[model samples]
Target: MAESTYTVTGMTCGHCVASVTEEVTKIDGVTGVDVDLPTGAVKVTSAAPVAEADVRAAVEEAGYALAG
Candidate 1:
């Protein structure tokens, strides 16, 4: 398995986390998601390394920005 951490912006509440999680969970191979709204930290665990482009797109789909 593989894990990656990303900083997502504009996450301020439970709904924010849920939205991000929903989008990211759609990615193939993703096994888990952990989001810390206060710090905008999102840790993603997957069966394989996930592509950066896919992560970014997922974040966008959730109405947020993935920090560079």
Candidate 2:
């Protein structure tokens, strides 16, 4: 499994976490998603290395921003 951690901005509550998780989980090959609201950290597990742009787009679709 390939795992990646990304910092997402604008996540203030559980709902934000859910939204981000829901969106990121939709990406092809993604097997799991874990969001830590307090630290704005999102950990994604996949069968392969997922593209950073794909993660950024998913986060944006969930109304968040992926921090560099």
The residue-by-residue lDDT of candidate 2 on 1-68, one tens digit each, is 99999999999989999999999999999999999889998999999999999999999999999887
Per-candidate Cα RMSD to the true structure, in Å, reads 0.5, 0.5
Looking at model 1, how many pairs of residues clash? 0
Q: What global local distance difference test value does model 2 have?
A: 0.96
Clashing pairs in 2: none
Where's the lowest-lDDT run of ten residues in candidate 1? 4-13
lDDT scores in order: 0.96, 0.96
| Distance from true location, Cα of 63 in model 1, Å | 0.2
Per-residue lDDT of 31 in model 1: 97
The pairs that clash in candidate 1 are: none
Residue 64's lDDT within candidate 2 is 94
